[model samples]
Target: MNLSDRQSKLLFGGLVVGLTAVGVYLTVAAPDDEPERSKPRSVVTTGPTAPVAPPPGIATPVSPDSFDVYRLLPFSQQEFATAADLAQRFTAAYGTFRFDEEPRAYADRLAGMVTEQLGGELQRSAAAPGLQEERRAQQIVATGTATLDRVRDIENNSIIFLVTGKQQVTKAGKRSDDSKQYAVTVARDGGSLKVYAFEPADAGQEGDTG
Candidate 1:
């Protein structure tokens, strides 16, 4: 059937509170005295967001070709590679959004990479009428970076990761940035890693885009 039908099968609301909490971390800065004026774009699409060059010294997956090969030895080579890949994609999907477009379209673009439940939640959140108005009024668009900080637990069925990233907000043309760290958990679903839950990373607490 249709995508919405598929997602309806997975409907649940237990994580709404937690997800809203995560969204709260996306703080908006006070508008600058001379807010940079940005030309309004006519459309928005789901194509890959402009690539964000990872900052220096950020944690990343140990490359198979690098000297740090031993760092990835604890997990099976295949699982480590898959988890790393998922972490990156999840970051890209979750971190990128365009305020000029319809929210459902944005959520639709992210659907394939996430679980049905999450996809539905995203769609509902995006479809909220006030969301678009708020973005338009604020004249802001945000792009985020997701970096894999550490793999805390790996099991046959799931993986836990600590992720950190920068959320860059461009408002009325001027840009401001903030850093967020999260504990993420993902499970293997049909050979792909899909995020199950996420929370702010505390000084000690630990845990992807899809």
Candidate 2:
């Protein structure tokens, strides 16, 4: 071939080669350009939360030692001592007296003490006919023993105690005696202990016997 014809033929061959190279590069690089296969978007979800607990309530524990008797009676140490003293005085005052004596002074003292310790109920019970006969005929002696069985906190500044004891009566010349159980409910009134209730388990026992 002549020089011009040969040069043109060589240029055409070079162009074809370049076109093939570009096609191969595009096929290989197209897949790589596609957004990197996103590791399937992980969704981190948390579990359900736990429930919250409530606070506790106030607690009051009763004593088993004197629980039964204490429930029936409610008196404090000082009040019980005073009741016992008054009972002794009553015994001494009417120990050997005839039933006709009024027992006014003795009853007055008891009334006052009852008002202080047990309020009106005990005083009225003492004034009952049946109780009067027991006091006179049996020469009843009132003895008291005070015990702190248990202290229960009823409130921040208040407490209830389980208290229990005995009261007895005997005939003037007889050695045999009859006794009954008593209970006192005591509460803190301001700074001092007060008897909220005083109950005799056998107030009518004397009448029952006769």
Candidate 3:
């Protein structure tokens, strides 16, 4: 939470990038007579899914990958899926680490997966004494999983996903679980997806505490 001025600006910028894309997609892609939510909450959830009414433009329910909006976006269907997957993968890596590794060593796990700016912020956070001290004392070794809860935002070349990261921490033979929601932004890096920003949801990806 103690982010530097530069890191704060990076995260805030990512938060705003999606609104324009959302507006563009909604205006240009919809030919339906009625307007309905394009991406329902169930589009990505952690629990059982019930049948959802298809959006106004689509006559029938479609699988996530088969959604019609992908064709309307600057990015392709494959790229969207790949971006979502990268967001989840980044969340998992962010939560997983060993007690013995130095803080920088922990940050290295995220290399190549994040932008240079966000990567630096993560490294700095990982090195926070309060966060690392307890882990080292407890000899914690964490393994985690990330569930994409929903798409928070999108642009021509980026997607921000709301993800829940659950980590099982094993400390001195005892295991416990913890989870947190994050606004995870993945943007196009050359030809591949890379995480451009990550922050706890409470930080308000929308500028609150950015």
Stretches of model 2 off by over 4 angstroms after superposition: 1-117, 156-158, 176-183, 188-192, 200-210
Better of 1 and 3 by lDDT: 3
**Which candidate has the top score in lDDT?**
3
Question: Lowest summed lDDT over 10 consecutive residues: which window, candidate 3?
Answer: 33-42
The segments of candidate 3 whose C-alpha lies over 4 angstroms from its true place after superposition are 1-67, 205-210
Using lDDT as the yardstick, the better of models 1 and 2 is: 1
lDDT of 3 at 87: 89
C-alpha lDDT of candidate 3 relative to the true structure: 0.86
Better of 1 and 2 by TM-score: 1
Give the C-alpha lDDT of model 1: 0.72
lDDT of 3 by residue, 86-146 (tens): 9899999998998888988877889879998898998998899897898889899999899
Compose the digit string of candidate 2's lDDT tens values, residues 142-202: 4333434444334332333344443333456554433334433444455454445445534
Each candidate: RMSD: 43.6, 17.4, 35.8
Tens-place lDDT per residue, model 1, 19-131, is: 77676665433333335666455776887789566679867644457656535454566767777767656765676787797787888777776778877987888778887
* 1 or 3, greater by TM-score: 3
